[model samples]
Target chain A: MGEVKNKQVILKDYITELFKESDMDIVEGAITLELPEGPNEVLLKNLYLSCDPYMRNRMNKILKIEGPATLLVGYVWGFTKWEEYSFVPSSRILFKIEHTDVPLSYYTGILGMPGITAYSGFFEVGLPKKGDKVYVSAASGAVGQLVGQFAKLSGCYVVGSAGSKDKFRFSVFVNTSKSFANNLILHASPPLHLNAYLSTTILQIRYFPEGIDIYFENVGGKTLNAVLLNMRINGRIVVCGMISQYQSAQPEGVTNLKKLITKRIRMQGFVVRDYYPMYPKYLEYVLTKIKEGDIVYVEDIVEGLENGPAALVGLFNGRNVGKQVLLVSRE
Target chain B: MGEVKNKQVILKDYITELFKESDMDIVEGAITLELPEGPNEVLLKNLYLSCDPYMRNRMNKILKIEGPATLLVGYVWGFTKWEEYSFVPSSRILFKIEHTDVPLSYYTGILGMPGITAYSGFFEVGLPKKGDKVYVSAASGAVGQLVGQFAKLSGCYVVGSAGSKDKFRFSVFVNTSKSFANNLILHASPPLHLNAYLSTTILQIRYFPEGIDIYFENVGGKTLNAVLLNMRINGRIVVCGMISQYQSAQPEGVTNLKKLITKRIRMQGFVVRDYYPMYPKYLEYVLTKIKEGDIVYVEDIVEGLENGPAALVGLFNGRNVGKQVLLVSRE
Candidate 1:
């Protein structure tokens, strides 16, 4: 078997708090070019690796899973290893890319995990009807952007919230007021009442004066508190991820949960891993939308497997503009 | 038309803080004891009044819904003038008491609002299965007792928590350690981490060490924080009420909300009103369960309409042992 150098990002140690680049080290490991002796295991040349906040929780030694090596012909955005080459079970590679007319790197985002997350969470959990008002937090991220687009495509009025002015600008279809973005930064660390500007009518009157029908929760903490107050009776909150709380030593307490009883709200938390069965159906719908140009995807790609640590760490800081991708190989 | 002295409990004014017996005035007003001129309006003598915590929120001016009235009923524990008699539309009355073979006052406890609250919250929202592990908060109160019984009837293992040692004794089938009940009071006001004892392994090991499959959330704030940490994957949290937070200036923050993502929990809030249609179906089921001694209900009945304020306020303080009912008239 021919051997090739596999450059990998190794965790230097278990992380208990906020993630740093120094927490990981670049290791030069060697991989056999051939697949392992099994009926299903395949060796793959990793192309696009996704940098997401969920990865932070799995860094704890208790939650670790072994990964790397597969002879896969196509691509996916599922878990493998943080390396240039990987050998893994064929089943571990979630969905094989069937439609290549779109960019292959799109596997890391809209055509992959984030895509199905938006699809199932919005339609299955949120159950939006026509003319419903939708609010999405972390609106320019991989999952949030798609949720906003899917809501818009379904004939719903959509409003979005993001941390920076740049994210509000980057999100083309989902509209959020610049003042709201400023307030997000301005009220980042204040007590909830002091953080009450967005939770009150000032933001509500401008965005959804009637109140929100669906709230897509990506960033938790203060934003969740505001959204809870702004939700209409029978509103649905689809909790996909809570990026804002990932870095904190202890996530801030959310105080407005009483609204859940008052409003008869249905707030559900979901993980995309349980929803892989929908990926084929999602691929069928999303591919058509992308080909027809009815939906658009924005990506911020960083080149090289060695830079994966920095790119992944940037997510909690909101440094990337869209679906953050690490380019490990081309062709 | 007949004129009679109708002793009424009138709000002194809108209350913005803790409720007191002084905030209500027992006024001797005159009632004609005749229905208003409408096809549906009717007049009737008042009997039992259910004193629960939800009325605390309705005391605010903004959420006001005019109440009191109705003629045609054997007995019911719905809203009415806290006086000797009432005149209102027949539609204003919720469910008419069809079965009075048990105590006529039961319409205020197991046969009325709290009955449906427990039934629907556990069966519909909770969706318990045989062999599942369930947890209930406020175990001796109106709703919690029935939820525990329903879980046991479904062949599931159940545990409950309440504010006082008396509540533990007052609840029937649900078994909770005395230590868990004590912690509910001990950690009542601490920060989430300092309040982490119950949220950690001590409570989990003693209770559902396998982790809770269903959590019936009656007392929110710190209790909800603890339950979230001890949930199994794919668990469901049916939030029927948040009694602990009713009197707080600002409700405490729950920090373990991240468990919602890690465990993929479905936390839902429901008001009892939406499930009223299920009342006929519920009444049928609960009646059979009660008659067979498959379930039992406890009532802490106080005499006089004048004592309503004390009974209502007692809910927040956990002074009452079971479902607190105010006996306006025994007939």
Candidate 2:
């Protein structure tokens, strides 16, 4: 019995609870070594934790709001150390992470839900037209990188926003540099309208001065409110994330919704699960782009499971650049 | 000069502007006898004036707003008083007064611009699918009467609001008295939701009980604000007029446009000119229905040129029970 137990693999997972305090508690849960019974289920030793805007929805008890509520509450509650979580991700029914050629930690960032989100939203709802102006917020983060690249591939004028000058410069350099390196031709066309000379920060300031036809919304707050005023007539806003407002007790104020009437804007929210059917097509297309050097991928990888909590928490503070992923173990 | 004028019949007709405050000044522009130029432009005597909601656009100082603002303002200004308004009498250009054996005053009310406004807006924009709930403000007026009748003809369960109970009862009675009314034929199903069994009223409170799917908006104010909140998902609002706000110094507060986002409602402001091409088919169909007793046609015929101002003003006040037309020089 002692020998069998010695051979057994023990896993450490982070958790929080129904405590009144807003801080997350890293509580321990029962570790299991036996294989999950479900045929499709993959026993993934979670290398990285994804902190996303949609997860905020799951944090709150589901109110019958007329918008898309969070689907992540189950996972949040399951990992939370509480006698009554009110929700939990069922062990056998969890979405399993499949094999990826890139760093497994990418599952928490680019190769995970956020990447799929950016891909699906930009391709589907945005319906990017060649030469159309594209705007993205939190451009240095997980989803924004892939979205900017996708926009470039689709022959769109992509501009993105980030927190610091370093991050902003990095995004711009990466965007302008990678496409050239990838054999994806990046040519400067006649600057379209008033937005031609503007930087991502100024573009955010002007909310796409000439007017953004397509917006990949991530960081929501005053930025979103600003974007609302500048959206062109018949604009499309893909509600990818509202990261800025995720931790706040109150949602951000949106004053410019009246523009929706005159502009005929379509703001749609969606989850990656809805895009699973297009996975093969997406994988084939994105993988080809990556292999051909048309896609420049970056990651801020944290080594060891001990550093996962700090790395994950640092995301809210904009402490990490590119995709923040934790290297749980070296196989 | 008298001898020269005597050779031709001097037709000094006094044309009145339907809307007094309109930018179109009803000047009695003098003209000597003129030869008929074409079949389309009929040089009819300035007999009666058509007071309509569409005329409001003509009265506005043209602003550079999106859409054909110039064209709309120009069209409205073209209807100035005492001017020989030469227009195509074809159903494509004007909603011709069918069964011309009726009073020329009918051209302004039951058979004129307002008639087509009611017809096109209610049928085309409203798209009243059978069993869908409908709400029509100014239900006793020119446009609202036809809207209610058309909804009923399309096998829709209809409820309309008027200033008085008499007009309300009359609108419903018109539907009941019709020999081939859809409600009388195969009974249309009730609304699919639970909150559709309440009585509609001129007061906005009536909306809280049963949400409206199609709002044929002729009156805008608290009524519109109420409708905004009560609109179901994908609801359609046809903005035919803002009678309540037109005469007011300030447009009424619309605090509930946020509902439009969640509901995905489509509210459009359009003129009858959009549907003018269909006038021939519309008139033939509408007249046939009236003749076949499938639809009821109602109007309030105001007597004499002196009463034109009173009748026009009555439109805003909701004093007129049905279509308001001034009978000037009788045909």
Candidate 3:
């Protein structure tokens, strides 16, 4: 078991420039299959790797580096590269896969961290009710897709904004760029000159005519500003990820925060780690939904560990159409 | 009743420039003190007028004009002038004052709108637990003063920022400008050049060594930016008011919103109206505290209705040391 060669992705240097695929170096390494001599540690084979936007923050020096490279770690840790056959501590592995009928890659996404994120962020933080008007950004991503489905299941009118219309088959697929252009044209008339600040507001009003009750914030910046204006009184904004501003030199200032007070909006940010106790419940519910065909997921799988860097970097540029997954091993 | 002279304060025109005493006009007019023929309407003499920072927004064309001139109206209404008498519709009044032993002006501050604002913003929105580190901005003002006292009662370590040190005896009164200067001097060394963004972070760290569990935000802009960086994981910021930005041509953009996700903070904005149902519970609790000498209030009273404009405008400049109140005929 100790003789097996391990392919590992290593962060060669902390990113100084906008993150690129070259920053991460894939190197061939070796690790023992046997568990280390500790009461708490366990050895397991790496199956599927997740390509998430949060990993970009880790690549830069912004996020702290710690813990094993697996789901449900005690604390948020740095990302592991396109790697295979790595031995992680026991606690790092949230729960062992017992259900084999579902794809093993689902654990890395819809059945794992992203799954719980969508659940807790939408239900707990978002506080969605029946007939709620929900708007989700990055609609095709792992978490956003699940959030929209959950909202729809709750009898909500869900609209999603994606980088491109092809990203997801949403009830209303708003191409963010085209929407902005339309907003400019609509507000070009006299007595209503729209600036970048007001333009977002005008565009969002056009998208969600009745106003949004729950905003599942996946991409922050202009999208967040736009949603702020269109939010109904007592609206809830669940901040999951700010993928758009993750690699920017300076984060864009949210100018429409005044609406928060006027509309009495609640904007809360959450990490999935905080709600790990509900993972079992979430898994049961999501698995049932998947089985019932009530919840559908879209995965953009990149074969081989070598393509991991490009797949991960593609998240920032909105290159990947869906849940970006790096396939590490068949086992 | 129609023969009585009504000293009226009327908004002569919408303000385009920075607010001044001249924005409001005082005129002697007449109104029937008798209620009009309506089942929902009641007529009462105007006892004390509350001078609040939110009124600054109404003074400009920003806030919509609606409803009558009194505290806790059905909806947030437009500003009224520095006049002695006026007839307002019955439903516009939230609740009739039942207790009279305390100053009638207390209804305008500690017992009325400001009192509930503090109660809901601190307990409901801020969600401070025992022994939590709490920070309150605009410490000496109506809402801020009560928030600090409430936090202390809850066994939380409380700190407050005020325009002047003499304004309310808080546990810690951070003179904002002085704190900023100190932050600048402390970060004069290499690798720590403080910009507008980083400077606020440094200042907050100095004030809150253990990080803040809850921030009772009243004065936003730079103060909000500062509190964001110093927020502990899962911290709550109750956005009660942004007095600093109410009169600005363009509200300052908050740049460190990414910290919301990184720190898992919940920044919620609320109006006191949402929690009006809890007014009874809050009033009883506050009245008990007042009787027990557990709470003390300070009111900066401006005598006469003519001085109302100056008192109202004084809030923007931080001129009023405490709860700014206009003595309109203390019936």
* Candidate 1 global Cα RMSD: 5.0
In terms of lDDT, the poorest run of 10 residues in model 1 chain A is A178-187
Interface RMSD of each: 0.9, 6.7, 1.0
> Model 2: how far is B75 from its true place, Å?
18
Residue pairs with backbone overlap in model 2: A182-A293
Chain A TM per prediction = 0.88, 0.71, 0.84
Candidate 3 displacement at residue B252 in angstroms: 1.1
Q: Between prediction 1 and prediction 3, which has the larger lDDT?
A: 1
Q: After superposition, how far is residue A40 of candidate 3 from its true place, in Å?
A: 5.9
Which candidate leads in TM-score? 1
Candidate 2 residue-wise lDDT, A153-194, digit = tens: 888777776552222222232345546223222223323311
lDDT, candidates in the order shown: 0.75, 0.53, 0.71
Q: Which 10-residue window of candidate 2 chain B scores lowest in summed lDDT?
A: B65-74
Residue A54, candidate 3: C-alpha displacement in angstroms: 0.6
For candidate 1, write residues B1-331 as lDDT tens digits: 6788898887777777778889888899888866567778666677777777787887766767333322224555467767778765677746677787888767776778888898989999899999999888787788887787778778888877666322322222343332222222222433333224456753488777899999999878877888887899989999889877777778899877878877888888898888888889988898887788777787899999888878877887778867888787767
If ranked by DockQ, best first, what sequence of candidates would result?
Answer: 1, 3, 2
Docking class of 3: medium
Candidate 1 segments exceeding 4 Å error: A32-41, A65-78, A89-91, A164-197, A201-203, B34-41, B65-77, B164-197
Candidate 3 on A178-205: residue-level lDDT in tens? Answer: 1211211111122322224334543455
| Residue-by-residue lDDT tens digits, candidate 1, A148-261 | 888877888887766632232222233333222212222243333322545774348767789999998887888788888888998999988887777777788999999988
